[model samples]
Target: MTEVFDAIVMYQRDHKEKDLMVKMLTRQAGKRMFYVRYGKSKRYQFAAEMQPLSMSTFEGVINTTGLSFINDVKATRPTSFLMTDIVLNAYMTYIMGLIDAAFVDNQPITKWYDLVAEAVTKMEKGLDPQGIANYFEVQLLPVFGIQPTWGQCVICGRRDLPLDFSEKLNGTLCQQHWDTDPYRMHIDNRAVRILSKLAEIDLHLLGSLNLQDKTKQEMARLMDKLYDDQVGIHLRAKSFIQQLTGWQNRMINRQSSAKEDES
Candidate 1:
């Protein structure tokens, strides 16, 4: 039996010769993998719409006992600009990988699909790629029930405390808590405020906001640690981003400086 659905291509792998294996995050059925023959032929080369972040329509059979095969695929919007720019491509790849890792098969996360679609559209229209990525991470956490406590102290529940997002407490920690625990990751009030604002804004408006370099760097670190701790590892695309953004180079320089200082 064949069924039709709207889907976003999450990842694709070339199989033997002309075959392709595609992982799609569908609006109706969630994450699913499908096999397609002649997927690489000139006539169907546009079917490379199966590449990461392409939104499309799919018609296929759900193989109850074996690998599923898709009979028809039509690209709705290729989101092709995600591939044209280096920074946008890396951000989209990381977010797509996050969705692929977190959601289960056939379980609908309609809101997430919409958020991703919107983010891609914004990027295509010339939005600040880094800010959009930070916004996506903030909004995504709440949807997954992994929201970091930022409005108040995660440890003491003190609403009046100074803002300091500490990973040790898993949220914004008050000064008292920070003073008591020397191991906590100290995030300043500016960073905490930016995170709080990012969580509250509509995804479409993410492009309109301006974020300081320091805040963006801090938020990136916070998000990287959060995903690594929750998802058990970082996405390779994210590491690619750190390299492009000079994050890895800075760390190496800092380590070298520290070694020289010790000597």
Candidate 2:
């Protein structure tokens, strides 16, 4: 029996000479892998539509053999623009990869599916990609039952203290908690306010918020560290960003200069 699913292509890998294995996040079946025969052939080169982040409809058969064979695919929304810009492409790949890793097979995540679909649509429409990514992280974490408490301390439930994002504690830690721990991430007041606003803003308004470059960098760092600790992996796109922005080079140069000054 064949099943039809609405899905977004999460990844694709070469299987054999002309075949490919496709991983898709489906609305009905959840994350699934499908085998495509002769996917590289000239006649069906359009099947390359199975690239990461492309939305499509897939028809395939599920059997007990552990791999499903996809009979046909129709592209519903090709986010080709995401591929046109290098920075956006890197960010999208990282975000999609993180989501793909976070989800388990056969789990129903209709809300996550909607979130990703909405995010992609916004990206295609020229939304600020970085802001969208940060907003998504704030919203996505809670869906996985790992949402961080931003307005108050997770331990004392104190709402009057300033917000400090600590990966060690997994949420905002008050001054009292910080004095005790002494190792929490000291998030500034502006960062806290921005995070709180992001949590409340709708997806459509993501691009409207104008954050300074420094604030965006700080929020990105905090979110990346938080997710890295929770998810047990680092995003490669972050390293790519560091390289593109010359941040790593500057850090290295500063270290060298400090050593020279000591000498």
Best by TM-score: 1
Any residue pairs clashing in model 1, and if so which?
none
| Top-lDDT structure, candidate number | 1
lDDT of 1: 0.75
TM-score of each: 0.80, 0.79
Residue-wise C-alpha lDDT for candidate 1, range 234-257, written one tens digit per residue: 679888998888974688789999
Off by over 4 Å in 1: 62-66, 73-75, 139-147, 155-162, 175-177, 200-207, 229-231, 247-263
For model 2, residues 1-263, the per-residue Cα lDDT tens digits are: 98777888778999889988888777776777878888767787556577777787767785544777777765467677877888788777767776776778767676667777888887777776777778777776775568677767778989787777777667777777887567877767577667767777777556665677677777877887777677556667766865765764588789999999999
lDDT of 2 at 230: 74
C-alpha lDDT of all candidate models, in order: 0.75, 0.74
- Candidate 2 TM-score, C-alpha based: 0.79
